[model samples]
Target: MVEYPHPVDIKVHQKSRFLDIAFDDGSHFSLPCEYLRVYSPSAETRGHSPATAKLERGKEMVSITQIEPVGQYAIKIHFDDGHNSGLYDWRYLYNLGKHHDELWQAYLDKLKAVGYQRKDPELAPPDVDV
Candidate 1:
């Protein structure tokens, strides 16, 4: 079993599209909803084989609609895009927070390599914003 810091608070900021988590170890992080969905533990993203992991794209506007507790160890995040299979355990969440920078950079690099573009809010028409 992987030992990890348990969360003291989990706050979903809809306006910012991020989940702020404070752990018992004094580590606090604001994990973006898009980041969570793209890196979902579900096979749809990271499968049994590394090569099977899909390069998630166009999720720039994705947000978590609900967060369901799974027993006492994990959470099943419900995304507005209908994804709810990823079970983010305490350890996994901790790891995500701890290594957010590197992970996010990697995802961006991968997307660039594959020519996958995430919807950019800045690119929106002047009349509307996403």
Candidate 2:
């Protein structure tokens, strides 16, 4: 069985809309609020299955308003857009951090394909990997 990574620290920089997560494995990631919001694990985004997952749009200016911890396994992030149902676990966060570049590019590509213009360029910077 695979073991999930544990986070050592989680800091939310509301001003910059950055969520910095430091894992016990010594991996640190600076995740933009937009990225996290778009990829939220909530049913609202993921739906009932992988095939039913929906692409989020027009969230370039979204910011994390609050982060509520859920037990010892995950956190429920509250967005300024009033989306507060997603639960982000340690493993998911680590994976998101590890694949930040590819995931971000994919998000951008999808946005372009769907003609969804992003308002904030800071959402997906060229040098986002950690």
Every candidate's lDDT: 0.86, 0.87
Candidate 2, which segments miss by more than 4 Å at Cα? 122-130
lDDT tens digits, residue span 23-50, model 2: 9988889898889999998998988998
Native-referenced Cα lDDT, model 1: 0.86
Q: Considering summed lDDT, which 10 consecutive residues are worst modelled in model 1?
A: 121-130
Residue pairs with backbone overlap in model 2: none
True-structure lDDT of candidate 2: 0.87
TM-scores for every predicted model: 0.89, 0.89
**Position 75, candidate 2: lDDT:** 91
